[model samples]
Target: MMRPVVYGALAVVLAVGPEMAQTRPKEAASVPAKSLADYSEAMENLAEAASPAVVQILVQRVAPVGQGDSQHMGFVAEQQATGSGVIVDPDGYIVTNAHVVQNARHIDVKILRVDERGQAPHGHLLPAKLVGLDSQVDIAVLKIEGSNLPTLSFLNSDTLRQGRLVMALGSPLGLQNTLTHGVVSATLRQLKPESPMVYIQTDAPINPGNSGGPLLDIEGRIAGINTMIYSESGGNEGIGFAIPANLAKDVYLKLRKDGRVRRGAIGVIPEAITPALAAGLGLDRDSGVILSDVAPHGAADAAGLQPGDVLISIDNKPVREVRDLALTVFQRAPGDELKMVIQRGKEQMTKTVAVLERKNEPNLLEDQASYDAALVRQLGILAVTLDEKVTAILPDLRRLSGVAVAAVPAEYAGLNPGLLAGDVIYEVNTKAIASLDELRAVLNEKKSGDAIVLLVERMGQLIYVTATPE
Candidate 1:
């Protein structure tokens, strides 16, 4: 079983190149006689409009490595990173890739103010604080205290036409104010290992340090954020991808309000419907996502969406991949109900599923504990307060009490009588044990010869065990 906590928060920032320019005007002789003047004027206006909003980001960080007594690894001393960002709001809110400033302790945002001559001679450098970061979307927002800074507006990504002229502006390989022009090579390009959604594919040279930069349409509206280049040499090879501005806006708003994106889960495993699998299951040649497992009493299970059932749609939108279904459901608020289309055998069925607030599950860690003998006074795993998921598996557990065993060490081996990994300790010698401190106090009351009894819940069964002090 996958532990589910492996996806750590890390946003990927992407950046651009110079002959493959997107907005460069061809020689007058090469252009059609009609609309030639308008095209040149529009290209000039775009460069004038978008240059002020893009900023460069410099970050410094420090990290710790290895076991005890190991030296501290410093992001500041070991390496330095540079990337680009866009000004999202007038109040100095900047949007960039999370990887640009990962673990950054200090961030500097430089806003370039172009002079009347179209030259960026002067600028202001401001420090920014991280607002929130989402690795799933590879986006992060930072807020700085500044005034009169320019901001860019996002255009609807759906309106972006394939092969439309697009401009990419950012620092590439530490070269500041570098500009590259190219067309939207393709739309709906899929990204992997993190974001499964589509990206805006461009042939523009997206190079290092161009990450977090803006991908602009001919009208100068922001289309996507420069994100990645699919290349073997780790350099641009005419293929790059940018997270669409529409999706970036969605992630930005969610991260700003909730401090994290809460994805709705119906607690069901979805299996992809392939041709062979569909034929084996007697399904249509082309149809829906198959439910492999239904978590009992979960939103999907409660809605009568059973295992092996084909989920065709949610709220009228076609549900193809599990990611698509997940994104569709999470766009709504908790407690909102929506229609779900499912197919069982040869019959198509519909059900309404209520969206529930996503609950955050933290890795269980034990509180500090001490031993009277062996002089072992190290803080180790103790117990944890029970939750709905834990209580459902352990029956006969009272509503108000029980601490799940989280950790154990070799020094505390004698205390491992009835305590197992999932065992919940409810009480210590009839004294209530809610938190680790309470259990520690009760255990401390023991004399050298007194027997200590612990009430524990092991796999839905409650039992009591006693042990003598060392």
Candidate 2:
């Protein structure tokens, strides 16, 4: 006999767990724990335990008339984007990638309704509402109305050792309740050099529709959220990434409660200490992070921290890299005291500083100067050419015939980084957009899942913004 993984409290509204009769585990399996002969069974057991919590997510937005792709891509007013999610709270709260549901005017969640014997009946769709989103972490919270919904167990990802068995569960390409098996290939895989968060790398065959689904450990506990894949063939080739459960937990809790995140900040940019700098600064090893710049009036400045100071540690955690200090500080709340040890000149000193609320900046715009315009609404933004009417409202934009965002839905505001009403988009992937037709041509050549770059001009300043088509 087999047993399913069941959960309780702040659990879920769907009542998805196996019936009470099957709640109790059967007699111990004959196979030894984690043995080669038992691994297959382990995977099966994991699937049985976690399947109830997996859900298919559908995000549909009504495209504006005549706004379809140029290649006769079959214009349809209502198009759907699909992904997956896992129930976390008994009250029907679910967790998924922000991109999976962003820009959707309508959100629907499909659950595998289960019977007493843990057998799934035909799944059903339930209307869901977006609770909160944390773009930086790529996590979102959604809610449906129900009670006693089964939820996945969250494990401490810090203890996730590489080479351990884990399962990726989700709907891939609309195939629901699918399970893929693999071992954690690496831990703490940094996606970008300067990114504050890192991912747990796996080989679990994650694909387009798998985003936001649970990556589970052998014990049927959620280890991470399978996010993306890297493949030359545009399919999973054993390289996949998942956000650690701890980070997801933090984001979901804050988003469900506050609907927004206010990350803490200390206005100081640090760089890894170099040999030359170490020699120039005096006798010392090239260790710890050294502040290269300090923002005026920011928390670091208020705490008397200045440029050229070496940050030895924060809150007792050694800071040898920029991310080391950044991840620690950014996760803290405003006014949280940070005990810092620093080396300024030859004097070693300690300082206690309060974290300041990080100020929100417009999406980092990379498109500077000017380009073209379009009526493309792929990224949930209705855009038009920066024509005479737009220039009259903002004289600074008069010279550039760029694509100006005309409108955006309030719920999906933060997803399109660095874009706003009236800002002109001048470039895409380095190609200049000089007219509406040019912008349409560039966008039409691309497909979903391809990342595009836009150089935006706002308030006489040029910045590059990166976004993907929905």
Clashes of each: 9, 25
Whose TM-score is greatest here?
A: 2
Q: Model 1, stretches more than 4 Å misplaced?
A: 1-38, 63-78, 114-121, 193-195, 321-323, 329-338, 357-470
Residue 154, model 1: Cα distance from true site in angstroms = 1.7
Clashing pairs in 1: 11-99, 14-210, 14-211, 15-210, 15-211, 21-181, 22-181, 22-182, 395-460
lDDT of model 2 at position 265 = 81
lDDT of 2 by residue, 96-116 (tens): 998787656789999988667
Give residue 149's error in model 2 in angstroms.
0.9
lDDT at residue 193 of model 2 (Cα atoms): 88
